[model samples]
Target: MVSFGDSKFVKKVCGITQASYQHGWDERNGGNVSLRLTAEDLVGFDDVSEVKRTLDLGFDAKVLSGSYFLVTATGRYFRNVISQPGLDLGLVKITDDGQHADLLWGYEDGAKPTSEFPSHLMSHIKRLKVDPEQRVVMHCHPTNVIALSFTHELDERSITRLLWKMQAESLVVFPEGVGIIPYMTPGTNEIGKATSDKMSEFRTVIWPHHGIFGTGDDLDEAFGLIETVEKAAAIYSQICAQGGEIRQEITDEQLGDLAHAFGVVASPKFLS
Candidate 1:
């Protein structure tokens, strides 16, 4: 059995958390990541059956019963993850009933999973129903995306169209567009449910005045989705700062052409 410290999963989590911190997306303990792990991914780790401890999920998650996830720990700083992964991350297996999880590795400091664990699980459950391959859910307070929530209209259609117009790659990266949820207390079942409901239709969801939730088939895909959207938001913020006036921007027809060229469908509602 390979040592947990040398496992590829541990290395991936460390790298991502550190990179996120470097990008300024995760400050202090502000962001969290959860990756669904398959049985195959546990091959190098020893003693899968051993449970270091059990944690109550606070809510039923029977839909994800028996699944394993690698998640960041609560109150742990992303900047510290690379240097002390075992203390900042954990490997947990959802109980057969899903009301609890068993720690299989990591979490060396006896820390619990992220406070948003339910939110992550909620997203994973919904995303899996739509895209069975979905494996990662990432949440962070991206400056521009959060700023736009305050200045721009919260109407999903308008925000989606605005973001699509901000960058040519925006439409291609998230053709279904983004989902917007009115301000709701984070880390609660209500917000988790709202975010999950949105995930049924869109891969990205903006928590008005807070941050964004992005899901994908892997960590990179999920992180890239958030990064692309945040970049567009940053461009929009810059334009607004220069002068909240738009002399020219990507038109609907051009968006259509770009989508066609990319062989991807832009959101019909936004396009119209």
Candidate 2:
């Protein structure tokens, strides 16, 4: 069970998750997203049998506690996200202890959360140490982003450098820049480590042969950043495919100047 200090926040998360799902950005079962609300909400299980099964499946017991996590239910459809375009998605509240997880309202029966819950829960605990206020953490497999990720051999630092040239504010706005985690088998603790590490630096990460994960001050901003980075990557890929090279690479100084000019930090070079 997860507890929320604010019910409205939970509804907001549900709505955004649903909208992103509908946008064709979140392929079914391809990724998972979560938001951190309480930082210390209790983890929920169907019963003791579930807990034993989780442990038998090799999950740590410590991961069962967090403030509150908005997870995608196992093998569930994104279209059926708890909330719709203009609906209040509903709330599931659990206490600080794993006593109960109750869906306040707005969700129909048979709707389960995403299987990526453990990864989301673990990532939150790690990222909060860097930015305590970040709320929404999203994972998606946009075609262009994945395409770019697959075509190259990139370390997290290199990708951030690339994004910085293409958009600088994104490089440093959320503190650090983009991170690229090595591919991992999904729904495993191995991926959790990579996710946590990436979230600490930038708002987004591109998973090779996988997808991308993003976090933000809110859901809208987070999703927007994800879209922006994907667009940039798509354009870059198109240029490369055409046998054209990046026309110009801006210096850090110019990037800083652009950031100041925009009233926000962004990469210096654009489609000019």
Candidate 3:
């Protein structure tokens, strides 16, 4: 059997995490990613059922029972993930009772999954309720997004509209708009709960003064959601840095047209 280190899932994690790090988004272990896995995805691995270790989850995740995930390790640097995936990434299966996890592969040096694992699982539970295909949760501290949270209003409508106005792709990419929750402590169940609650309505959630949470059917999709938001926020920041005089911008009507052109439904909450 091939080593988990060489698996495509691990390679994807390596590529995306490295890319996120290089984008100046996740600096010094500031980001984490988790991808849900199906039994089919684990089929070829020898000892797939072997538990290298068992971990306490510290919270009930009954909805996640029997599920498997590939996750970044806590305290592992995204910059180093590409070069040391075996130690920086791990494969785990939620215990049947959902109170613990069985480490199936990777985390070769004995490190545990990210402290944000609870948040990721919480996001998965809520998002899967709305989107059965949802499989990935990515959290990162993008400089631009965080900066916007400080300068822009915290309401979802305000943030979503500004982002939509900054780039036409913003409206097309997330026509349903984004959600924003008040700043909360990271890596805690409370923050996870808030994020997942918002995930029930939106694919993206901004944690004010902290970072952003994005969900998708796959890693690329999830990463793209966050990347798009950051791009819009970056443009906004650039405008603000240049003395912030808006000669003109993408109007709400234009955003509506963009949505219609792209066959997406603009969220009434933000667009109307």
Q: Candidate 1: misplaced stretches above 4 Å?
A: none
lDDT of 2 by residue, 2-100 (tens): 333234555566666677777667776555566554523322422211211111213342433434445455555556555341222323433335433
The RMSD of every model to the true structure, in order and in angstroms, is 1.1, 6.6, 0.9
The lDDT for every candidate, in the order shown, is 0.91, 0.58, 0.91
Model 1: lDDT equals 0.91
TM-score of each: 0.97, 0.72, 0.98
Ranking by TM-score: 3, 1, 2
Writing each residue's lDDT as its tens digit, candidate 3 over 106-178 gives 8989899999999999999999999899999999999999998888778888888899999889988898899
What lDDT is obtained when candidate 3 is compared to the true structure? 0.91
Between prediction 2 and prediction 3, which has the larger lDDT?
3
- Candidate 3's C-alpha runs over 4 A off are none
User: lDDT of model 1 at residue 72?
Assistant: 93
- Candidate 2, residue 42: how far the Cα is off, in Å: 16
- Sorted on lDDT, best first, the list reads 3, 1, 2
lDDT of 1 at 171: 95
Query: TM-score of predicted model 3?
Result: 0.98
